[model samples]
Target chain A: MDNSEDTERIASVLNGDISSFEPLIAKYQPRVFATVRRYARREDEIEDIVQEIFIKAFRKLATFRGEAPFEHWLMRLAVRTCYDFLRRHQRNRETNLSQLTDAQNEWLERFHVSDTADSGDAVAARELVELLLDKLSPSSKMVITLMEIEGKSVKEIAEIMGWTLSLVKVRAFRSRAQMRKHLAQLLKECPVTVEPIKTS
Target chain B: MNTDKLWNKLVDEVRKTPSGHSVPHDFEKRIMDRLNSTDAHAKSGDSSKIRSLDLLWSNLVNLARQATPNDRVPFAFEKRIMACIDVPLEVVDGLTLWSRAT
Candidate 1:
């Protein structure tokens, strides 16, 4: 269904008609899960986080004054939920960064750079990307995942992260720089393609 | 490379990064099941008192508007109210008895 229809349906659900909410869940679940998976470690945890986000959204539906698009609001909620999950998990104990071996690091480094490479190069690149992402700070990784990978605009990201426009831009820029530096180092070590593409 | 172009390339690369893990096939169903159960639980627990109060307040306001002047008295009208209140029931009964005797 279109956004307008979804809004109307959500409004109906908020007014006590429960069945109207199913379409909304079906429509936005993939995006929500994708956002959650960027930060969450376990598959079960990702599912739980997504469920929590949707449940929160449904419960707080009354507070949604339509000031923003429904999808934008939902995205904001999803990002916040992921952030909360990360923070909660971090408080429990230490993360084992030393567990990454040379082979795993190489695989992850390749994954990030080759993710955008030709279809033949995708698999190897993906492995590298995953590894590199694992090394990043959750905040940095999240910023990149939402603004870069998800293609959400700066304004939308600011809303999602509860950050100022300038802050979002700054974080995005920093995150991109970090990823580039890491990928560049990986590229230097492995030298995936000898000849660099000429840029004007 | 110019920072702008470099940034774009980095973003492009990140976007292309494949999540090796596939989302579970029943992901939506699981989410919906949880949402439905939670929603049902919430509705069952929520009180209808607010709705009832709103209806009651609305009716009261409408009734106040329809009420005659006699139904609404200002605090300054106490003298007139006291004068009316002074008639004892025995006096009233005795006056009625005298009127009947006459």
Candidate 2:
């Protein structure tokens, strides 16, 4: 939806026409789901977070000053909500290296055998990345997800997160370091069996 | 392989993974229900009571956290807890929606 339509909808909702918010929800739910899915794995958790985002947008619609597109404002709230979700669930997500599934282990084993090895197993790579992410502190998880996985620039993340550009850059750097520490540990700790290459 | 190279490779692979999850079938409906109920609660003037109950639940969660060995006790957990229940309204709203959704 365009900015003027968004403004009209916000005005309508603020004027007590609650169903006016449904169009906004329809327009943004996919993007919001994609973003929230990065922070949560379960269907229920993703649903709750998405519901919370829209509900929050509905309640806080009055505060949206229209300086930016409604999408930007809503997405900022969504990212922060995901950050809060991460903090709340971080305890349950404490990384146990032992919890690494066979797929993730095999992916690490392949990477260990050869940097040039086929990284064709996208599922395993994704799982390994999530395991490493679970090991990070919440801020690091948020920053790294935005920067690396989502491919958002520091400036864009700063805008989304309401952080200083320097802070975003600093956090991005530290999150990378933290990820490296975890990755190195995984490399050291994960069992690897390299099959010998047969020469004809 | 260098850690940087491996990290970059892994991120590349993950980004290539399609974001396969569509929004749930009835998510919009669930959200509207939650919003409607929250509005009802606010209008019914049960806001303060809901907030206190929500704050109490948050304190209970934090109390449970104190049992974890390495976790820091939130410096006088009881004294500053109310300050931390930032979205108490949502607790009631979330519970109401969750029960209905399930």
Candidate 3:
């Protein structure tokens, strides 16, 4: 069902029609899990996070005014839940500048270049990208993931992350540039050729 | 390339990046199960006669308002209201008698 229908169903569920929530879960579970997985490390961790997000959403359903789409509101909750997870774990502990290893630097270099290569390199590139994301400050990584991977607009990212529009744009730009620079250096070191098209 | 084009390409590349995991099949079922349980709890806990009485009274008032002045009261309106009150009074008397006997 479309968003409007889903919203109406959710409203019905909120008003005591419990059966209406099933379709909402079916429609949104993928997006919700994907959002949670972006920040969570283990499968169990993600599962817990997803459950908490839904429980929180249901409890707060009475407050939903339907001003924005329900998915947008859910995404905001997902992002907040991830941030709370990160904070609780203290996972984004600061990295010392002088402690960078050669292997770590090389991995970072490979990560940025993965985007421009052929399909064969995609898997390796993605792994590297994941590693590089782990190295970033959690906030920056989240901003980049939401805006780039999830295709959220800056306004939506701001709403989700609870940041101003300018802040979201600034962080997104910097994150992309950082990734691009690292990837470009890797590409220079290991050049891949693209075949030219021949006209018959 | 312009920043707009570069941004678009970056976004497209990111979108194409596959996630290592898929959402479990039981995810929705689990959520629905929780919602259902919560709803059931709420319904059972909400055994308030006051709310139901309010709803019934409001509905009755609405029905009366919708009727024409000539058709406002049924021929047996007084009898129906008296019967409704008498049934409840009889039930209360029976309950009181049982309580006294026990």
Give the clash total for candidate 3. 2
lDDT of 3 at B62: 33
- Cα lDDT for residue B42, candidate 1: 76
Q: Return the clash pairs for model 2, or none.
A: none
Among all windows of ten consecutive residues in candidate 1 chain A, which has the lowest summed lDDT? A191-200
Give the C-alpha lDDT of model 3: 0.59
lDDT of 1: 0.60
TM-score of each: 0.51, 0.61, 0.50
Candidate 3 lDDT, tens digit per residue, B1-102? 999999878766765667754445466699999999999878754543223323322322233233212112224333332333234224458778999999
Per-residue lDDT for B1-102 in model 1, tens only?
999999878766765677864455576699999999999877744433233223322222233223211222223333322233333336457778999999
Worst 10 residues of 3 chain B by lDDT: B65-74
Give per-residue CA lDDT, model 2, range B9-54, as digits (tens).
8766765676674355466699999999989978755544334333
How should the candidates be ordered by lDDT, best one leading? 2, 1, 3
lDDT (tens digit, per residue) of candidate 2 on A6-95: 899889988977667767776777678777767787777876787788777877888999989999899899999999998888788766
Question: Looking at candidate 3, what is the lDDT of residue A135?
Answer: 56
Better of 1 and 2 by lDDT: 2
**Poorly placed runs, candidate 1 (over 4 Å):** A91-116, A180-200, B1-102
DockQ of every candidate: 0.01, 0.01, 0.01
